[model samples]
Target: MVGKKSGKALRDEGLERTDNNMDLSSWPQVQAINQKNYYTDYLKRDDQYLAFRLQNEEARTKMTKTAKDRDRALAMAKPEGAEGEAEADGDATMEDAEDTPIETAGSKVIVIHVGSQNLRIGLSSDALPKTVPMVIARKASKNESEDHPEPKPKRVKRDDGTAEEPENLFGEEWSSQFNRMSADLKVHMRQNKRRMLPNSKEMVVNFNRRTVPETISEHNDPMRVEWTELSKPPPEYIVGQPALRLPDSSNPRYKLYWPILNGCCNETDYKSKRELFLDISLILEDAIKTQLGLTSKKNWPQYSCVFVIPDLYEKSYVNQVLEMLMREFAFARVCFIQESLAATFGAGFTSACVVDIGAQKTSICCVEEGMCVENSRVNLKMGGRDVTETFIQMMLHDHFPYTDINLWRRYDFLLAEELKKNLCTMDEASVSPQVFDFHLRVAGQDTQKHTFKAFDEVHLAPMGFFEPTIFDNSDKLLGRRKLIERSVDIYDGQSNDPVSTAQSEILTALAPPLPKANGDSQPASSEVQATPARPQQPSALGRLQDQDQTPRSSVAGSPVPETNGTPQAGGANTPAAAPTTQPSHPAVESRDDILPVFPLDNAILTSIAHAARSDEKKMKDFIGGYYGRWRGHLDQWFLDERLRSLRPAFTKDIMIGVPPRDLDPQVVVWKGASIFGKLNATNDSWIGQLEYDRLGHRLMAYKCMWAY
Candidate 1:
């Protein structure tokens, strides 16, 4: 408390009585902060709230645009009875202008490479393609008649003000424009349809599949006099990046669907086959418009497209996809490319064993001189998602036991992916001391901080590829090295080493005849025995024939017996000596035997060494870290001297392994498609729109021939 003599004191100490607090309220920074607070208050919502508002706003905007579009379209579609003279005058004025085709090989090219997890799309001129989640959600609609299109007119006027010309009817431009407009109409109508829950009075099929009557009352029944249709929102197909949010339960009415999976048309989806194709086409259009920044609607018909599909895509599916694209999008030109070839070419590899690790599985294929070795291609059910799941389970059981499994599977799976990106390492060690810290968020819970160490568990995901036991029935899967071995063998036939060749011949020559049962008379031998036959056990040749063990390679310099003219030594595994008392089978004949020999070719070893020296992480990690656990199959393939010897003779350069992301395998397909488009332009190799139409679905067979 201050004393009451302040006035007198103030008079005595004049200016000192004034308040000394600095006035910072008028500063720009303070004002800016205040403005931010006001802005936040004005918006006042979380993501879901904003999304709700934005969706409604978008619906309004779409309706306005659609109404305006409809009006403009109707005006354009008006019969030319009255406007014939005006249009004739315009055509007369523009008659000097020459008509040109819209599609040209030199035009812009669009490449879309669809993977199980993402879609990589870009213009051929761009350095890199844009990636978006391969997902789509159909939107909700309020009114059924909003997009109910009228029966299309018999003929639509051209933008050039010309009446329908008979010759131009078959013209590329007219066909493309017609197809595009028709596709757009169909898409709008499809989006406008309301997806209703079975009527409230109808039955509800619960998870148990029990049909129970829905909780509905007579008051809400449509049959009631006062009942009316409730206001419903307009439906739209949520596609690409935006569709990712549908899984959060924000808009339960919108279900997500994948138009393409594992790099081909999706067989399992919530959408119809035609619907799926339309969705993918729509997504492609959106990607072109939004991501590539190609806004001019007229420029669409001028673009060519390349779709990179997986090697395993069925012929029928390929035909269907091609037909759909040609009928729906109707780009100037379109071509199909296999995913493996594209990746290999994109990586600038002349010869490589590309191990593509995708979301659904890991596909390995060998490419020699830009061609995929058909027989060597193999697929594994383990991939990035599998690794994430393993990590999630580890965290749930070993680290955070209280977290809900279902919630983690739904929401935290993304966190697991993030964790993998941050903490996962491909170090060539059985165990690593890598440690990382990250946050995990549950739907209704606070974010929890987690410190994850013991990267041994993290290695399990990649290791699972080498050791199949990490997952169920994975033991049937082949390891990376084995895949390479098999691919090399397929590329270069059986061993070419002279010694192996000779040994194989000798073994084939010495193969004993099939042994007869005791009840049957023994087969007579060509050579007669000097000693009288003793009624005793079966002869040594008969016993050996009976054993019939899988033939294996003999060690170098093993002894060969000449008694009874029997085949030299049975095999390296066979004993050096046999009892002299046993007589040789009389019917036995001298012949070379075939032996199972896994020769580790020197070229293969050299290839592996080259890969290791070049810092190929997958091969390096496989050799240093995974070899011990995966040696059984690896040894069978790599330990053979013949394979090692044949490796040098292998003319093509061999790449040991490819890491999933080393060269950005995700976008590699797009890059490959771009390369193919350029090559097609240079060599005039691409099939034209006219040719495609003439051949129809047979273009796929032609593509296959060209690809092989």
Candidate 2:
């Protein structure tokens, strides 16, 4: 009976046996806390409500039923063996696969590009990738999550002692409710930034924002309050965008972060590292459903996932995290591709150097014949954000007499980024400094005139990529042109010095002719007899090896017999007799012919590197394509004279390939990733789940070596 006793009864009996034991339930404050809220009853008397509570409940039931019906209709519309349709406006379907017959195998292809700032998702054959800010904001209230809260997994033990297939704990009712809530909240948040409230008489003029109130007074009108806030219990986490915390919230535990920073997951903080791992998996799952049209939870495991990351990040722990996610999500197959390499292939190039300039950093790599040259890749910690920050610092330095650090902190960096996109120009001459005047509102102060001279100074910020020191970086900081030069220098040697160590090494490796055959008797002429006869054997140095075997004619300008056995005579039609024995000089191939092959033959800069690509063109003095877009003061300080010197004879030019006119620069990587998925499907390049489980990270690491 004791063993069967309830836990509460056993605890109470133990407490009674102890003389000094105190019963917390007997405490007056504890009792009061447990009592019903009488104030809420008083408040409810004045609160607006339906004539009957039953009617209100019935209305909610009807709405719930309607949402279920809609979801069912949507599900019914999607038939088995039918390919998911790409969004008509946001994304374009790529050249239809020659054999797109829907896979009867039940597996689907989903390509996802997770960048430092945004996430792009689309089906394998989609021409364009749908982009979403890699953001997932969570509200603190459990109630808010009821509608679209993430599905909870339940573990079930099997007879074999291993965990069986996990079950989704939420029922259809919750799923439908969550879906409706997600739709409503999305609409609310999107419309929250509008200049005018929907169906409202008031216009939200400059600096005036419609605000939501916590509660309505009994005497005041409830509908008069414009609801701008989209979250309840405030948002506990905001991803992608800047972090915010409401000071008035009771529990303002907020977290905003990027799962990836500098192109990889943060390894320093274990908690954040794990959180990011889970977050990316969840985000990718959503992409599979929303973008690939695989809504059935069971079918999720049948989707192949491809993650695009920087080439330099292969050695990082990202591979490990990806493997973990692969198993956790039960994906049909998975693979990783380098962002720049994907872009190169997507641009339809067998080889081209790639320069990827993103929001947080820039990477330059040489690709040759479908392989990335590991030694030639360079990653720099400078990109679009730094330019915007430079603009912000410039404004703060000039405008606010007594700079409030908070003011600077509160300023919208996104707005500054947009301004940079619009007003920033590549040509220094176009920078016309204009006096800008605008009304500024501080958190606690009245609106005031915030006036400052906005000059072509904006153009100077982009020059940081060219001259890192302007942004307080060391001389080691490499600009776009310098990046290209670095790649070329690997083969051509430094321009300032004629003989590069690489060139010398190559020269040393070329074998000299075998010791001349000993001419018995008299010591072989004291004068070293030049071996006019080239080596019979070919060399590693290609045809550079000398193969001529003819004695020099002592006559000063005598024409030598042509190798074709044609006797040359000085005639008007005859070219000067080919000087076969003129000079046995070592072969010096032009830089173009000897350029080391890389994964990409040309340096193709995606949209983010528009500034760098533009600056590089100006440096090289190229005046075609997008070069006409440059309209700025010519700043010599930002120029790389070395690039100008090398331009005339430089064999290879950094190529910023012209993308399809409708494609956005930002989506280039995703488009490439999408195309890659299609190629993988056709080529059977992806590692299937069974093989992945068997080979594991070793296979992943091995593939990373040449996955591009």
Candidate 3:
């Protein structure tokens, strides 16, 4: 970072700090990503293997098991505390006090933990576990909505009953509800309006980026027609005022654009852990209506389920992805497991840790004796995508030295998934383990030498909450300086601007003084300045003389060929620029003088205005940590309390599965999510609106680790 400009310096001319997110098309497609061949290509060939969602057959059986066990446990449990303790003191028969249930509802049960990826259903009778993916068809829309846009007529019971809705008949699966909703009084939120207010700050935060930007205008071309002059208005309105031209402004489907879970229209606007939960649940409930008819409240099914996800687990994508899932199951409930203790009971892993590796980030947490530890948790920016990007860069540098988008196209998402399932782990044995080689070719020509097997198992990969670094056998292993320097020399625009020149200097300037492979102490850099045309090149070379071992790789490549196809670098005859290599990634740092980013809900209106005027770098700085931390904190809190009460009931270890609608309430379920925006654990989670045994027990858990 020596010669590299800090984010502030990069803010003016539009160079992003981190190039994580470049161009992601949001244009509505004829098909959803789920319906596309691209996404399905990665699914393992064992597609026949069952996905363990709450509705799976095995999950139904668990509900029966849990109900039985709960009946037994309560029967065997001691009665009132002191009195029973005293009675058991002498008469051994006192142990038979039997903490029996107040009455017998005679109902079986199951706990459904709705996860972003999978839905788990637990049976109480046997505590058998079954899970099915939360996945439904993205293309499976309301096949009947348009034809029948009305809520199914409600049924009334005459058995001395008050008017009631489907709440009494809640056990309906999501698929069947969609059809029913279409046939009934249909509900839709498409009529609402949303707009982000403006600000005078003249800077904006870009929400769609994966990494913090070095400059605000890096990716976005904000339409800004600064008023240079004003023209008089027509006749009556022309009273001494001048007419001004403004860029067209509109916010269509703004509600659809904000985060599905956290984006509230107002402070008290449908926000609460419950509302978020209800959103997915309601969507799912509607999905089920589409496939089945409804009955009177008294004749309704017995359970409800909603998808739960840790806020930061899938990076900040949890909400966006959940929305996509909701597109599949309308009544789906996407809950942040870390924000609700009930979620921990849903994921199923108690007395252990859950570590989730998602697309853009990683998160970990622990549950002890079925209770999650609120204070202990970990979240990192590096996730499967980050790792894959590193791989892609490696392939570009070592394998394909060309710049053809097609060669490396159509795989950003697929490759990221591969990293999640195929890479990442802890291996303490071999000298180098997690690293492996990759092949990359844009147009043609060797770009870089691939090296890396897994995350950090080979060469040390960066690891930290914010900052990270790795080893480099090549020159200057800090920023992507060397490669950037080469790019400057090769490009036609040359090194005119401050950024290009500054980058070149950052790369070649700090030449670590060291002997060549032959071990010869190099000459002084001041004496190395040789070219007048590339004025600063030789002077920058002086910095390399001090390194123990200077690097060799440049930023992702050596120039390829001319349009006519010819090699662009050092040949057998030409002794060119000294081989300069550097670290694979650009060094990202947090600075004290850094621009401030406010809490999202605190100043929404002003932030929106600033975002419109400012560039991408400033925008990311404003939103980066705030959005990430909000979700992280939420996941932590939700899990802690949910697991507290489930501890005693986990008397015996067992794998729980899904149960039927009539039997779902008798079992426990677990859900996992990230720790941001998470509330602290508490003891009042026994009354969760989840399916539980007659004993009134509901268990929850999240995906994470204790790091022990």
Candidate 1, 634: how far from true, in Å?
Answer: 17
Worst 10 residues of 3 by lDDT: 250-259
**How should the candidates be ordered by lDDT, best one leading?**
1, 2, 3
Minimum summed lDDT over a 10-residue window in model 2 is located at 593-602
**Per-residue error at 495 for model 1, in Å?**
33
Cα lDDT of all candidates, in order? 0.45, 0.42, 0.28
lDDT of 2 by residue, 1-708 (tens): 446677678688884334567666765663355455544454265223222333345558999999999898576553444444423311332335433666632136677777766778877766677766664545444222133232111123466855332111122322333334324433643554523234221121111222221332333432231212436655445443333222212243333344555454533222544565777766666666666677777876757777777765633255555675577777777777777677766666554545566765566654556656553454445466656655554433323221232212222333365556766655534444354434333333343444444443465556445433223221111121211221123455543212222222222221122223683322222121111111111121111122122222111111111223222212122222122211122332112111111111111121112212324443222211111001121122233221222232322442244446645556767767777766642543455665566666545534443732
- Model 3 per-residue lDDT tens digits across residues 1-708: 489787877887688566668556687556447544454444354332222222244447888899999898667766576676755663664444555345322122323344333344432222344544232211112222222332122123346754333232212221132223222211221122212223201111121111121322312424222321313431211100011111111011001100121111111222443433444454334333332223222323342223344422322134333443333332212233342233345333233333333333343333344444442233322333333443333222222222221211222223333433344322212212223433332112222323333212111111111111111111111122211221122356443211212122222222223346898744323223221111112222222222213332112111111212222222222233343332111121111011111111111212211222233333232222111122111232222222222222221321222223323321222422222112223312122222222111112222222111
Top-scoring candidate (TM-score): 2
Greater-lDDT candidate between 1 and 2: 1
The CA lDDT at 197 in model 3 is 26
List, residue by residue over 417-473, the lDDT tens digit for candidate 1.
Answer: 666665554332323333455554433334454443442444444433432222222
